[model samples]
Target chain A: MREEKPGPLWLRLYALTVYLFLYTPIVVLVLFSFNDSRRNSSWEGFTTRWYVTLWHNELLMRALLNSLKVACLATFLSTVLGTMAALALSRYPFRGREAVGALAYLPMMVPEIVMGIALLTFFIKVGIQLSIVTVILAHVAFSVGYVTVTVRTRLAGMKGNLEEAAADLGATPWQTFWLVTFPRILPGIMSGALLAFTLSFDDFVITFFTAGIGATTLPLKIYSMLKFGVTPEVNAISTIMLGFTIGLLALWSRLESDPKSLGR
Target chain B: MKRFLAWALVLPFVLYNLTFVIFPLFTVLYQSMFTIDAEYNVSQQASLDNFKAAFSAANLEVMWRSARYALTTTAACLLLGYPLAYFIAVYGGRLRSQLLILVVLPFWTSYLIRTFAWTTLLQKEGVINAVLLKLHLISQPLQMLNTDFSVILGLTYGFLPFATLPIYVSLENQDRSLVEAAADLGATPVQAFWKVVFPLSLPGVISASLITFVPAMGDFVSAEILGSPETQMIGNLIQQQFLALFNWPMGSALSLVLMLLMVTSMALYMGLAGERDA
Candidate 1:
């Protein structure tokens, strides 16, 4: 690992070209966000009109709000349930534990289209009205898988000494958990929540099926716009979304780099 | 008290899974056996009629077409992704994380947005043809949109990152000393790569292919948005049946078959991968 043998220069250049090809479409999307033309053929003059249009569109605003609501709710609920599941699975020696773990992670592997259709069918049969609540519930069902994977790693890596020490010093289980265990794994929990939020926010297929009328999400709205054809407003939204995700990744990297911040 | 609390903590997940995931999946099989009407009433009669309809001559043709498209798209992803992933994993150090983030940022955005971006690039008056015309590369705009080629291109582009990351991880974890030793034993660089690198990274390739294949099999968005009727995949057909025709039974049957195909392929992939590892 310590050896720093430099490879051929052409090897590095070829790698850079590969990266460029992979990312050029997204770069083009971001650049075209500022194009003033209605058609996406040639870039005219730069303008912020599309951004303003996206901001002022009431339907888009509603969809954005719905997406935010579902993502936030799903993140919170999945984080709580997932962390508890992670803790239990990591600590307990129980029957059917592997099966439970497999069941928990199965949602991530199943195709979203199939899950969406299945849940939609289930909701119909069960007489549950499809709404934003249904969307949130569906999101939680999948988000928990991600949260479990993330939080379980942290919990598994965590030694039991701190919580045991707190209990040894006459702390209650609840107090020990809140003070000693929770703080140690908070970064993992937060990171998992952020990932859940982004996943739920960007989800389209499942949300498309489960969402009732008036429960449109940002993705559904963007999908509808695609059906109509490409618009500069779509580019603007993509650019903003791209910027937002990059910013979140940057912030997450910062938080992760601070080793002392995650004491566990 | 501790046992009770543990049970309480586990109950929510258990209940959610049973109600949502397991029940719904089994119900899909159940639903396919019954007759469902427009009024959402289900008849108790069991029959293979829906399966018959789904596997009818025409629909089977659609399934075959979808499979062919999925295979091509998966092949494209591997073709484009392997060399790129190999280059990045071997040569990229400081730039790897940044480049990876760039690859994944589109993933973080809506699938609709990325497909739409492709549309903007592929439409008749779109940037791609415009640039081609401007540069005099062709006398006329390429008739590229709404074809199998467009769907394949979109699916490949969308799934490239999914294929790249696993292979990259596997390659990054490869033992450098093994490669060095092989080279020192008079093996050429290409020989070392084929003997040492390819064999070690086969697991990632298998898993990557599975990940790419399953989703591409069920990916309705890319085909619906980017493809014409001739190129619509099984996903689009399933969606049309359930959403538009309100034919839950046939849709459920179709969905079941698709799921079975995915599971079977994935199982085979993992089986082969494990055998190779052993």
Candidate 2:
């Protein structure tokens, strides 16, 4: 029976209603970005004034730049570390290999708050002042886990003979990796990097605890702003952020559709 | 050559992970049980006082509220996600990827941005009320922001994709012939679905629930941004112990409790999913 059971109209209606409910808030944020007034709840005349204000907000721009910096650094480090870890674990068997794999996965499985506080305590105990550097270190810890998992799945499916052939042809292990294995698994690495970059950029809780003074990322900036009140300026910033995220997501999904294309 | 390179490649990765991830976790357990002061001094005696403080009436109330809120959010996501997953799987065709992207996009944005977006939409005289009032559907704006409703809405929206993707992956992989055979045997669409499709998709549903629910339980940002003081969750309490009150012991204890809850539930979820698959 290849036929789908037709759910009741009410069931479909309920689903549609839930979707509307889901999109409604996002739609409101995008719409109100043009509100002239400073307040979020009360709309005056529609204006681009808030967007203009957002454009002029130097502090927010700086925080955004800082976030970009940390995300890039974290992504780069984790991608290299994680891919190498995945390769080492997947390609060769060693004593305690499964145990090592479990350790690699631990960072991701633990709660953010626990990790955050743990990092906080570590930093304080070690007398390392909280800074942007700490945040990057903290992010890389978890980003490495995600990157390893993503890359491991790809490595597991990959045939090993290709690299063996390269080695039999007199290529060193490192040379074989760079010549054959690297190119084949590059897509997984790239996807992992993309995911790590996003996770680091958007991270709130871990960043909150690990980021000491002078390390205000955009999320932290917005969080601090919330303490005072919500404003149209925040809405304008959020709308732009949403657009950027969704646009990236569209591209990611498009790439994700073809499993072979991931190798690209 | 292979063995030498393997150890060379893996050593740094392994060592760093142990020093950072594994070590810190143990440190958290130790910190939770004992007190530390400004000079980084650890007390000689350990006590369960920290756990007691964390589970005190006031803090326990927040923990309970957090569980309630997380459960509600998980329920909402599953309910919304299943149909959407089905629609995309069976009906979406060419637009499937794009629709899936829509579900996942928000997760990339700064969580602050998404939660703030909710506040914008849910506040009194916000766009929702404006539209409703303009339509004359209501004379008064609905009270929305800083309420449980806004918190739940935000949590559900933010986590919906986590719920949908696993379910969609499984649904997409499902063999269509069984459903066809059921229909050929004169089974109604509902019967075919309940008897054929739903059972096969149970694993996806189980995993999706686990993915969304576990994280939602520990989520502090959504509650802080969307909920009022009264609606603050366990996450907020944990934050208080670390940031506000500077109580490391209490923070550690709370973190352990949160970890325990998540582990037990996740294990249960995986167990159930395994049974269903079998």
Candidate 3:
């Protein structure tokens, strides 16, 4: 007997069509990245020359490295701060708890342009020069909310029994968390860190306002390249970036699903 | 012990938010009110002159265009995204996570690159037109680029995943028995959906609208690459003021207005959502 499911065959076709629409432009870009000639719309033939050219582009490479550096620092700082905030929110009841929670969640709500300009104004008012440090600070500022939300969900799913049992066994509060609580929420922390890293890596608008002349990131570089004309070199760089993002997301989803990694 | 531990852990982030997010927003308001000359001389009293100029006929038209484009794009996303989200949540079975990830993969790519790809796909002599020509559908290529159509298309394409994810979450969490109960009571499939599924999934739709509209209203990338000058949005105007024209007061004023518009809409949505969820 055919399974008369609520979701029908028509739904599947519709879903696949939507997926095709979403993926086609990316496939086009990846295809043209290897074109033997410099036409964006035509396939002259296959060649890896664009990849080689991209490899040799010093300015873009520097930008790529800067993105990595910022992502790493921002991810680390945000994970630590956000994890602490999450632990606090879940562990205690206090006055103005709702207010604090709302305040912490504001970054997730505000538009990027607004957030970008607000920080830009703050930096200029305080006379702090824009540079790589400023970029990292801005990235961390916005990304902490992402981390807190992720970690808070993890902490919510957990039982207080484990930590209480640890304390009942004469373990110190710090030791109990380090041994029992921390390990259980580690997956959430890792996922949050991964999210922050990816967000910082691909950031353009916020960086546009906060970054100085010498501290351009990869997206900023690509934006400038688009100004001249779309070229195969940009295509090659985009392909590599697309691959990197996919790999990271795969790792993140893996951590998310595995209970053992979540200290089961 | 627990209360002390909690506050200690939370205080640093609160401080950081105040210094970074809150203070800067206040500065935007302050910056909007003052006029500065060539030598950086500051005006003492607050003035609405900057706001007045920003709301002048020319700039107000751009703001109106931006909001209208955002609304159209949000509607397009909902029309296209809701069905896909329903399909994935209902029929994806073991493939649910995989398919959801597919929706997110495009979102993970660089925004600039994503927009750049559309230029190739939609340009006058681009792939779509080339294919159409080869198919003998049209003699001349369609002028797809440098138009509002292309801008809306790019914005929708780039943002479909944002629309899908929230709706998918709500759909996935819904009790299937509600729909089944409706079906068992002699309701048609379309009736079951309209009466049961759509009402249940509305919170997701509301959130999807919030995220989509906020970013779409502030987007300049789609405008700069896909739209002509006549269709340029307030974002482009703000960018011009800050970057090209060096008119800081006007730019700040414009930013605050956009921010106010976004906040009002968000608050309205939240108030409605709170009542519904309650």
TM-score of each: 0.95, 0.91, 0.95
lDDT tens digits, residues B1-278, model 2? 66776777677678778767777788889888897677757678998777777778988788788778888988988888998888777766677777676676656676677777777667786677888999999999999888888888778877887898999998999987788899999999899999999988988888888888888888888878888898887778888888997877778889999998888878887887788677
Q: lDDT order of candidates, best first?
A: 3, 1, 2
Tens-digit lDDT string for candidate 1 (B1-278):
65566667777877888888889888888889987777878778899888878888888888888778778888887777777777767766677676666666666666667776777788888778988998999988998889999998888888888988888889989888898899999999999999999999987887789878888888888888888988888899889988898988889999988888888877886887788778
> Candidates ranked by TM-score, best first?
3, 1, 2
The 10-residue segment with the lowest total lDDT in model 3 chain A: A1-10
Worst 10 residues of 2 chain A by lDDT: A1-10
- Candidate 3 wrong stretches, greater than 4 Å: A1-7, A262-264, B37-41, B267-278
TM-score of chain A of 1: 0.95
Q: Could you give candidate 1's per-residue lDDT for residues A161-247 as a string of tens digits?
A: 888899999999989988988888888888788788888888889998999989998888887877667778888877876676667
DockQ of each: 0.60, 0.53, 0.69
Docking class of 2: medium
Maximum-DockQ candidate: 3
Report the C-alpha lDDT of model 2 over A157-234, residue by residue, as the tens digit. 888998878978999877987878888888778778878887888888899999977789988887887788877777
Q: How well is candidate 1 docked (DockQ)?
A: 0.60
Q: Which ranges of candidate 2 are over 4 A from the true structure? A: A1-19, A42-46, A254-264, B36-42, B268-278
